[model samples]
Target: NTFFQISDLEKKLEVEKEKTAEVSGDDDQEDKVSMVTLSGQEMSFESRGELEKAIKEMTSVVSKAVAAKEFRKADDTQKDVDALIKLREKLPSVFELEKQLKVMKQDMDKAIKAKKFALAEELHDDVEKLEMRLKTERALQPPPPKDLAGRDTHSVKSVPVVATVASAASVRSAATTPAKQPVLPKQPLEVSGPSSDKTVKHLRPSRPLSATEDESILSITQMLATKRGNAALLVGPTGGLAGILTDTDVTRRVVAKDIDPATTSVNEVMTPNPTCVTMGDSALDALSTMVE
Candidate 1:
C-alpha cells in the first residue's frame, strides 16, 4: 500500500511538471511570433526611412515615364506617392514605444543574469504587452488630413498650373482664329496714336497674340518683340480675360524685382483680373482704365 501511494504521488508531480513546461513553451513561442510579426510589418510604420527611399525610386520612374511620353504612368505614380504620404501621416509615432521596449529588454536581461527569475518573467510579460500596444497604436492611428496633396499644393505657390495652361492654350487658339471669325480687340491701346479718337469697335482689329501663364517671361518678351505688340491678353478657359501681360508689367514686376525672367513665368508678373471698358467706351476711357 505504501509503495502504491508513493508511486501515485510521483505520477502527480510529473504531470504538474509537464503542464508547467507546456505553458512556458507556449509563452516562448508567442514571444517569437510577436517579434517576427513586428519585424515583418516594420515597413508600414518605419516611414521616414522607407518613404525617402520610395520617393526617390518613384521620382526616377516618373522621369523615365515622362521621357517616354507615358503620361498616364507618371500620373499614376504621383498618386501612389500621395497615398504613401497619407499612410505615413496616419501612423502614430513609434519613437517612445521603441525606447521603452529597448529599456525593458535591457532590464529583463539584467534580471536573468542576477538569477531573479520571477522579476525576469514579469518583465518579459511587460515587453510582450508593450509590443502589442505598439502594434495597436500604429494600426488604429487617426485618419490622415483631408488635404493629402496640400504639401504639393503649397510647394507650387500659385493656382493650378494645369488649368492655367489650358486657359493659356485657349487664348492662343482665339488669337489664331480664321479671318472670318469675329476678331478680338487689340490690347494696350495707344492713346497718342491717330486711331485714339475712334471708338474701340471702330478701331481696326489686329492679330492679337497671347502668352500662357507658364511661359517664361523672357520667352513672352521675345514673342511680343516678334509680333511687334506691346501687350498680350491672358484669357481664361471660357475665353474671358483672366489677366494681361504687358511691357510695363515686365519692366516693373520683373525688372524692378531683379527677377530672372528666363526662369520666371509671365504669371508671376502679369496683372490679374485687369479692369476693362465696353466697346462703346472711347479710347480715352480705355486708356484711363489702363492708367488706373
Candidate 2:
C-alpha cells in the first residue's frame, strides 16, 4: 500500500515539476527541496534540528525518493509534514501526546515490576509510536508567516486586503445611512430623599497596580493600606486600567471562593470594566449608573 501511494505521489509530483519547468523555463538544479504533497499543500520546516534529529517518521515514499535521487518527490512529503505540524500547534498544552506517553511509561514500569513482560512490551511499542509522532510533528512545523509589509515579494497579503475592503465598506455604509432623529431629552429624575453634601468625588482616589507587579505578593488589604484607597486598579503596560480590585472583590472572589490572597493576582480576582460617570454627572446620575 505504501509503495503504491509513493508511486502515485511521484506521478503527481512529476506533473507539478513539469508545470513548474514550463513556467520557469529552466533546467532542474540542486536547491533545498521544499516539499508540496500530491494534494497541493505546501511543506513546512521549522528548524534544521527538527529535520535532522529524527528520520524514522519519514514515510517510505520520502525514503525511496531520497534513495532514488528524486529530491523533488521527497520534498513534496514536506507538505504532509506541514499539515501534521499545524495540527500539533492546535493541540491543547495541558493534555497532549506526551502526557499520554508518560502515563503509558508509568504503566509499563509497573508491569515490569510485576513480571508482566507481555503488557510491558505492548506499552513500550505504544510509547515508541507516540514518541515518533511527537518527533515528526516538531520537525514539520513551519515558521510563522511574515506580516504584510515584511512579507517577501512572492508572498500574498490577502488578509490585509480583505481587512481594508471591510473597513471601506463600513465607512461607505455609515456615509450612506440616514442620520438618526434628535432625541427630546427628558428632565433628570428627581429623588424625594434629603440632599447629601457628600458625593462620589469625595471618595478616595483610585490607586493602580503596575502590570509587572508580582502576583504572589499582591494583597488587597496591603494595597488598600499602602495606596490609601478602597479600590485598587490593575494598570496595564500602557498605563490604562485593566481591572478593579476592591474589598467587595476580595469578599466575593477570594474569601468566598477560598482562594489564598498570597497566590492570587489582582487582575484574576478583580472586576473588569468597572462603571464610571463623567464629572458633569450629578450624584443621583452617578448612583444610577452604578446601580444599572
Candidate 3:
C-alpha cells in the first residue's frame, strides 16, 4: 500500500510541474505579442533594439517607394510605419527602470545594515512592484510626424525641364478659322529684339529655398532684393522643384492682402507646382507659355 501511494504522489507532482511550465510559456508569449504589431498581425521581437531597427528599415523602404512614384505601395507601407511607431511609444524606458531598481536596492541594503528591518522590507516590496510594472508601464509620448520622402532639402540640382503644352479650344478654333483666309506674305515681326532668339538657359537661375523652411516672407523679400532676383525656386524635401515665390506673388498675396510678411512663411504665399519649361527651350516659347 505504501509503495502504491508513493507512485501516485509522484504522478500528481509531475502533472503540477507541467501546468506551471505551460503558464510560464504563455506569459512569455504574451510579452512577445505585446511588443510590436503590423498590419493587424502580431510581430515578436526579443528586444527593443530589434524593434527600433525594424522601424528604421521600414521607414527607408517607404521613402524609396515614394521616390519611385509607387504611390500605392508607399501608402500601404506607411500603415506599417505608423503601427510600429505606436508600438514604440508604448514601450517603457528600460534604462530608467533599471536605474530606479539599482537605487532602491542600495537603499534597502543600507536599511538592513542599520537594523531597520521594517524599512528594508518596505523597500524590498517596492522594488518587486517596480520590476513587475516594467512590462506594463508605457512612455506614452506623442509620435513624430511622418516624413516618408524628401528629407534632405539641401541636395538641390538643376534638371532640364520638358515643356508640356496643353491644347486650348480657343486656339484650335482660331487656327481653323484662319485656315480659310487667303495667305499673306510672311512678315518678320520682331518682339524683344535679340532676346527673342535666346533660350531659357541664357536667363539667370532663381535662388533656391526649401519649402519646409521657416524663412519668413519678409526675409525672402530681402533675399530677392539683395540678389536682384525676381523669383526664388521653392525646393521640396526631396530636393526637387516644388514651387515658385515671385516678387509679384508677395505683392499680391501678401502686401495687397495686408498679410504680415515677417510672420508668414514663404511657402504660404508661394505658388505650388508651377508650370516649367526646359532650359534649352527658346525664350519666346517660355513667353508663350506664360501668356497662355
Each prediction's whole-model lDDT (CA): 0.60, 0.52, 0.60
As a TM-score, model 1 comes out at 0.31
Q: What is the lDDT of candidate 3?
A: 0.60
Q: Pick by TM-score: which candidate is best?
A: 3
Cα lDDT of candidate 2 equals 0.52
For residues 2-70, could you state the per-residue lDDT of candidate 3 as single tens digits?
Answer: 999999999999999999999997875454434333456667654444555566577567767977889
Least lDDT summed over 10 consecutive residues: which range in candidate 1? 31-40
At residue 47, candidate 1 shows an lDDT of: 30
Q: Give the higher-lDDT candidate: 1 or 2.
A: 1
Q: Which regions of candidate 3 fall more than 4 Å away from where they truly are?
A: 1-198, 202-213
Instruction: Tell me the tens digit of each residue's lDDT in model 2 across 1-292.
Output: 9999999999999999999888675422211234455777564433332432222254445556777888987787644543443332333121245567789999999999999999999999878966776675554433222221243332234335545655675555467753622221211111113224334445533544444222432555685777576766555333344446667667855686677778754544554445444332356766665443
Instruction: Order candidates by TM-score, high to low.
Output: 3, 1, 2
What is candidate 1's lDDT per residue for 190-277, written digit by digit as tens? 2225344655556555667885555678888888888898898765433444457887777756786688989865655566555555
